[model samples]
Target: MNDSDAINKYHLSVERADGQTDNLVVSEGHQQPEDVASTRLERVNLRNGGNVDYQEFALEQEMILKARGASKILQVCVMLPLEGAYSMITPEGEECHFTPNQGFMFRYIGEEVTFTLPGHQTVRSLGFCVSLDVFKRYLDNQIPDTIKPMLQPKEIGSLPVPFQIDNFMRETLDRNLQVEAQGSLKQIRWEGTALLCMALVEEKLHKAANPETFSLTQACKQKAEAALELLMADMQDPPCLADLAQELSITEKKLNLIFKSLYGDTVFEYLRSIRLNKAKNLIEQTNMAMKEIAWTVGYNHSTNFSKAFTRQFNITPANFAKKARKLTKVS
Candidate 1:
């Protein structure tokens, strides 16, 4: 759709090869009377009856958006706002706020909801809609019967922002939206991504439902935190997991469990993250040599450090430093 000075509004209709249509109405750069503005819409439909819709809205001033719609099919909606917080009011007057990384899951059954955004802010959201049968088939009866109630119509489920999954989801959506593709290839990509998204959500919900997977108590959390502090304080030459667990007065298995529960990473993975982050900062901010930086982060040799750094950040230390310096100079 072309941006036009005379056209105050644009309605774009996208027909997917899978026989789905997207009707989008976007603003023409000028703020609306309600002070809410939508820049554009990106939508993809899959052959499996799932669809992904993305929109970026900017608020020139504070306003409330009243959206009323009914669904002809039973579907699950997963929504994530990439920027700014917004309060949502359901038709029944139920209200909640959503932020970045945090998401809302609901089995939407034709209910209207209003979203309110503050002034001078932008909000980007990715929404996934999958028919009930498709969603259940993907789960393969893994979800417990107790949690099944959350899948009832109008029942909303809250997710605690699985960061790794969110990062992957956002990157996948952004890449697919930016790339120029048509028909079957685009539909295939969207289908694969939608499945992956559902897999991540299922894994998270499964973990939450399984008692053995998450049983960390307050005491266990404190012990895990203590272990983490020790790991960070002595990253150059940290103790092994067994010895650390010994120091914390917990069994190694318990140590591993609680650490993973509290920090979302294993003990060694946590150390690696700390090591890499410190190395990245040193590479960017300081004039430290590669070998020195490697040794500082507990890697005995620069090659191993380079491999780990590249595995984590997808950039070699030298290249990262070079780019950092170049960007710094330009700035």
Candidate 2:
């Protein structure tokens, strides 16, 4: 069979965008509903190639593949690790391990593989079946044919990415699933899928250049994360840049750069945004007067609060509060 036909015969197709197509099929061994659901769970012993077992435990998992049959295109499998490791055999026949904070992807055609799980691991995984046509459309517009091969099943296999990507994915999915606003859910879902695709492409490219750079040191990452947590703990009494730098035991300039690098905003800007958001929440959810809500969020002057709120939300505080109340009453 031709390569295209070979891909079609094996994996299911799922839609990635409005006009784009991609196909994904779980290994036939994973076709059973119970089996699929079992894989969705976080902690499972997965044996991929040899007799040696790899225990896979994730906080959450999601898979998106194109539709199945003649129209199939791309397949995406996401396994989010919560607190354990899983083993898999790479396309190069190398045995590799993945931690709970890591993920892997497999792209292939006519390749048979098995994922075995022990009965004790309890984890959640999400699977997406997408269509190839969607990916073709995306490729036609955004990807070149030379790179197109890279996106094909066999060309790219088992790319690993950071756990932050999984958190973003889960947040996007949960938001899309719970959103009740008209047209918002689909918009978010589509955006989420696009982000997932972009992440996959980035992983492939990164690995091609440097295969050894995927893992993050848990201790260092935790230290950076803890510093961020401390900075965010008190929005109203937000720390000055100097104070924050001292708390984190870094120079002020270094702290500013790090905050910007990690969060795409300066510490002061991030804190201001947080305070504004809190003010907004108070306005919408509580019976506090506008001035009191403003004070609660570190804004002492109602006028200054109104100006900041207007700049941030594109509406005056009073107006926003009024609209929120109206919407709540209508609901």
Return the top candidate by lDDT.
Answer: 1
- Residues 1-331, model 1: lDDT tens digits: 3322212233443332233434544432222222124454566655566667666665445545554333345566666665555677655666766764455666554445667756445566666776677777778866555347645654443211222334445456556556655677766666766676667666555655664665768898889779878887888888898899889888887787786777766678777888999999988788888999999999998877875675466455777788897887888
For candidate 1, what is the total of clashing residue pairs?
Answer: 0
Put down candidate 2 lDDT per residue, 1-331, tens digits, no spaces. 5534433234443222233433344332223323233332111111221010111222123322322233223443334433333454544465444443344443433343333222223332333322344444544556532244435554565343233333344445435434443355544444454445445544544544543322334543454576668756765576676776677676676554555556655566666678889888887788799888888878778887775675455456777788898888898
CA lDDT of 159 in candidate 1? 19
Q: Model 1, stretches more than 4 Å misplaced?
A: 1-38, 58-60, 141-143, 150-180, 211-331
Q: State the TM-score for model 1.
A: 0.53
Against the unseen true structure, what C-alpha lDDT does each candidate score? 0.62, 0.46
- TM-score per model over all chains: 0.53, 0.36
